[model samples]
Target chain A: MESGTARIAVDLLGGDDAPAVVVDGALRAVRADPDLHLLLVGPAEAAGEVIRALDPAQRARVTVRPVRTVVGMADHPVAARADSTVRGAVHAVRDGAADALVSAGSTGATVTAVALGLGRWPDVRRPALIATLPAVAGPVVLLDVGGSLEPRPATLARHAALGTAYAAVAHAVAAPRVGLLSVGTEAGKGDRARRLADPILAATSLPCDGRYVGLVEGYDVSLGARADVVVTDGFTGNVLLKAIEGAYAMAGGPPTGGGAPRAAALLGVAGTVVVCHGAARPEDVAAGIGLAAHLWRRRATDQVRALLDGTEAGDREERTDRTTDTEVPTS
Target chain B: MESGTARIAVDLLGGDDAPAVVVDGALRAVRADPDLHLLLVGPAEAAGEVIRALDPAQRARVTVRPVRTVVGMADHPVAARADSTVRGAVHAVRDGAADALVSAGSTGATVTAVALGLGRWPDVRRPALIATLPAVAGPVVLLDVGGSLEPRPATLARHAALGTAYAAVAHAVAAPRVGLLSVGTEAGKGDRARRLADPILAATSLPCDGRYVGLVEGYDVSLGARADVVVTDGFTGNVLLKAIEGAYAMAGGPPTGGGAPRAAALLGVAGTVVVCHGAARPEDVAAGIGLAAHLWRRRATDQVRALLDGTEAGDREERTDRTTDTEVPTS
Candidate 1:
């Protein structure tokens, strides 16, 4: 709802049906928001397709980076170092040409490119991909959704802090309650990582009036009954998000509010980045673009980073070895 | 459905709502199934309530086994050994007094009691809790729902075999395609455990014509579009099941077929057993009792065990140290 001129770099050669789907999505986004501008980073032909679809007035808002290289979904994260469109989009943000970037490419590649190009936050070892689900109560912020697939307890605790800030800053949830995702709501009812993370999360101080609400089950993620920000490892969060989307499909359609989000905002980095599903439809890519614009206009990335800095400064004495295993994102 | 006299031991002092929900579920099950007989194991007062609600003919099918001890959900699994109702129910199954047992108590307690009383299969180290989901294509059998929370690679491979055999024998799924649940369908898409278990599952031979379909996402669990049997760690399986149930609730109701199952069948034990949700309603407990009766009438436990024996005997060379960490069921 923050209306301003937000320039977003769109990776046109990203998704499975790239170029076409990305072109269609960019066109839809350009038409929807008058103040929104797009930096199309892909083949010139694909960028021209989007530009040609818009009227002369709308064409003034579109620009092209013209990068032809693309990363496949099966490529390794190191592949992002190549001259790819995702890397190009990240460069656009780093160079201040765009406020944010959106990609539907390989998650690992996008995460790596963003982290390397834009740099991660000072204390963030692994950047968390935060997906906000429209649950019954309100927006449920689920973190580490395919960003850091094998995060340690410390990383999970840090993501909890990040999610708490994101929920309050981006979604405008007051006094957000954070919970560690586990099999059961009991104190000692989860895997070894969860058992270790539970104590760490409880002892860690949260910003934005966010309180730690002990252990929560999967029901809390969808129902939003117990916690507003649900923290979990990327592996569980990724599969759980997809499972809920599939369940919605089986149940005919989503609820009155909306379904599981196809795009997630990548936090812990220096700039705003939104990642759509690799097999994203045109509308999903549009949503990703819209999310990027929204986050950029709100300055959510900088505000969340500042919030984390204050919390970390408050608890700096207890976080000496937190970044020992830094840069281990298993996407 | 298999029609036969199926006597099931009902744990009356189980679940959050305990005796009241247990009694209502028992009465509903007894009235619904003509050939179903129940041996209610709990306080005599709770048993009398169930008996008093039934007519003369139905009352003849109900019996009571008074056991004052109970295992709370927060209690350790070792609490089941203290003459608890779950222990009594397990003993009934072992002594041939009941065809199967149904409980809505602590999953750890039930698993511990059943594994100790009836004993695990010779080749099986961890007993799997299997929950069948009515998916779009057919029934998708998810194993290790709450039993064996943190299974090793060998245990997952073994559970894959057990799930495959159970799908063929219990659900009558012919040549069921089995999949190892992960974040993505790609070959190297999951965590360290999944990365190690993937190759092992591919090398292990399956029984009843079951084949490994490689890695599958969580959508396959609810949609059943890729595989009929999905294998994952109990921690992931447990949370995934509850999340699906929550999603169904958020979607207004379940599909015409059904929603996420509240009851899961315990396999690798010597007898048929059904463990309902810890916070089960009366209808959920009734569904658990009905599932127990169905599994017992079909002689699924015996049949699945025999099929697993055939599979293990054929692949004995590669599985010498599978039982090193046996009896580790972290519910």
Candidate 2:
């Protein structure tokens, strides 16, 4: 474990079994990590429940910032209701009351709140939700789990940079091999957006000395054989991740490495944030909280942002050089 | 296990490990089923290897058709070279020399070959490659595994009917619950294609009394908790299926029931066709051949086509009714 005090703001009523599961998860997280301090943002009673579960000495580690509103699952993501608990949690992080934040609410809401509170990194239109799956080679980082349902080709290219940096920053993977998820490994194997993004990714420079491994199949996401980082649109990535989890359950048990994650780290936003499953159990929430702290301590968001900035700067320079050179025939 | 003899043409030069794996799989399938007969399509040398492996009595069940051209993985699907082995296998079925066909070749090539040789079912511009995954509830039939990468809303509706009938005719599933695979179960929770297909499937009457369940997520495919037959675009289904297979492998091994099928049956074509993985091992090829035999004996393709024809007739009548009743205000 990293040796540092990480203050994490938790949404108290963001899940289906809100208040209860959130309280249980918060209490478990507080007990497990000694240096972890929590800023619970929701009903006073829910926050009190977490406080009561901790020891008298440990109670100092917990703080309450009461709020009442919640973003319902059925609600449209564009709404930024001021009283929402997720917004309060994001405020905590922005105001330096917390180092990071965790929510098991509607993913669209949490992502919106984070982007609104902390502001997005430059040139990143859609912040990606990255989930890491344990595989034989190593942890395979999959981006856009649910951030943007139908991203343009440029968004996919931006995500490749985010994923490559995240793999190196969060997972310490060196020279990560990035792959665009497709139906087959052969070129022109995917839909229109993927086919367009393939050549773009190949031409673009990736952070952390990462190399694009062209196209990869679904097995690469679980097996981690072809690429260390897998990039796809939010729709396919979201469904693919859940399918793998269901497969693990149907297989009687998960592999010795562990099953699919119930939590994902939100990237491209300027603050550290983790989104747990809406149907998150206590363990899932705890994991989400742990992930938030790990990311905060490692400064993963900041490091990834820096790498992207550097790559973009280099891209600008390359473009200038190419323009100065002679042009080839137009297609 | 069925009483009738199932003569299946095997594409010996189809897969990456062609000839060797195909030969081994044919031998295993012949040994496993007494009523099974194989018409091997490949080089004279490879066919001789299969003949030499079988006993004098078994030799009668094995026949060889010499063909030299092998479809390369990188080759275009439109290029149906005259001497292609996949074409030879398809011709065997057309000539009444085989009851079905099995190939571990490029999915697009095999699909094109089968469509051109035996011809496609009327109105099915794209034939679906259906794979049955053993889930908790029962066999969840997933369609368009690799047949149509990006199908229209009408095509998705067509596949729903195909899958519903398949679940009932092939697997004996009664009133199969059909669903459109999407990012979320909620209505309007997917890309444009899914949002458009949702109502089409809901209103379209299905044979076998199959009910259309609204949008289902990835978990529905592996757990089978939500639906019996899951439908998606060929690209998504293909990747989703492979992802499940990889997850099972990562989990030490498959479940007590089974793993995702490495072999999928081609539907909407005039004859029974099975496509194995291009990297198929001996066991996978045997499974593919076995699947072809099973499907042929059950007359699954014929039954499904009949069901579709009946459904389409009913649809035409409904459309005529709506037109006569007068159109409502256009959306």
Candidate 3:
């Protein structure tokens, strides 16, 4: 949708229902965005199927980089012997053939490939996967959707900073209020990890004039009346996102605005990379491609990095003590 | 709703909108269920409000147990100087004054009071809070919603068995498929707690002919296409239930099946107890009373406990390994 030509590397052999859905998704993305170009990374036959569907003008905007489908799950040891399409797509982004990359592959595999290929941001040890959901207040930014399953307290502090900046840089929210996700909004409410991480987030300085709101409950993630950016560990965030999606389905449809996002931006990576849900439909894959283009055009990565450059970790605990009201009202 | 008379002791000082909402709920419940009787445990003035609202015919079904409204939250230890309405309700059940009890008080306080007053089931160190969500497949039972914020791997395995039994006894779910909730369906996916709990759940012998379906994602909780009963730590389950409630709100309302249950059954306690959400409205409070009456009529607690008595802890590991098919495919 942006003005500049955004070239995205699409992993044609990424998802559980690969090639067919991927080919269909690539075609949809190409036809929707006039300034978008795609570098298809998968088997030539799969890429050819997509190319054959497009008209002459649209076909000229797409290119193919052939690679066989190879999964690299932790359970699959022999899977390492084969070259992966996810890695091949990463190479395309690294080689400057694409402005950004999008994949509906295994999240762990994509994170591993991107970290090894394009490199990670200097400060973030556990890069976060940030997803923006449409909420009543606006877009609510949630992070670490499967980036690091078991993040330490310090890692969570870093993610608080990352989420704060992402809300401003990516979504253009002014003075976004950031909150730590927990069982309850009340002070001293959650498990061990949350109890330790709460104070750290409270004292930590945020980018783009973002305010650190106190603890927020799970409700805030969907109905974003309390916080604009919600920071949580990957395990909780990942499951929460999926649970909301399921709830929407059970409710017959999503709200008029939209549903929880299937595409997430890989924050702390050097390049603009988007990961679609593994079980994503064709439309979800297209949305992932569109997200990659939007991020590439916005230069969100560099801007967020710049914002976090000078801010120190929360060491000023005295000023940030729980003397004030902390709970975001349940109702 | 059942044929037998169900006496439920209601805590008048329980919820955020206590007294007013409790009075309204008690009136509605008595009017709705002809076979239901209620013992109001709170201030004399609050009980009088409910009695004044009821007609002469309905007034005979209600009894007043006058106790001043006193709370025992962490915020107010001095508040404990007064008698707790929740404890009075618990004692009423213990003394055979009531068939079951319903409270919208602090979950920890209610659990503590019940465990001490009514006693707990053998070997259940941490009691589980079981909530039945209406999903497309049927009622998907979720447990440990706020009973034990941090549970050991053995505790989760125990809950898996408990949930399986409750599904059969309470919901009439035959041969419930129990699944340990995690980030993904894959064997190795999730946080440290889930990684440790996965195999334990698999090896565990479930009650009511229930089978362990391995790791289930958040989608299975709402959609119910994968598992009949989902087991998780109290912290995760607590937040997850709330998130689903918020999502349903965002989706305009719940599906035709029903919404998330505001009340959860407290298993492992030697009584039919239901705890409503703290933000329970008048309708939710009435629903809690209804759930307690339902549980009492079914003799659910005694039946579930009897079912779980013979099942040994999951010490037999060889028969249930990762080599077996774990993922329950979602359509």
- Extract clashing residue pairs from model 1: none
DockQ, candidate no. 3: 0.65
Residue ranges of candidate 2 with Cα displaced over 4 Å:
A321-331, B322-331
**lDDT tens digits, residues B6-85, model 2?**
99999999999998999999999999999999999999999999899999899999999999999888898877656799
Best-matching candidate per TM-score:
2
lDDT of each: 0.92, 0.91, 0.87
Give me the runs in candidate 1 sitting further than 4 Å from their true place.
A317-331, B317-331
- In model 1 chain A, the worst 10-residue window by lDDT is A322-331
Rank order by lDDT, top first? Answer: 1, 2, 3
TM-score of chain B of 2: 0.97
> What's the C-alpha lDDT at position B138 in model 3?
95
Candidate number achieving the greatest DockQ relative to the actual structure:
2
lDDT of 2 at B241: 92
TM-score for candidate 2, please give it.
Answer: 0.98
The TM-scores of chain A alone, one per candidate, are 0.95, 0.97, 0.92
> Per-model i-RMS in Å?
0.7, 0.9, 1.2
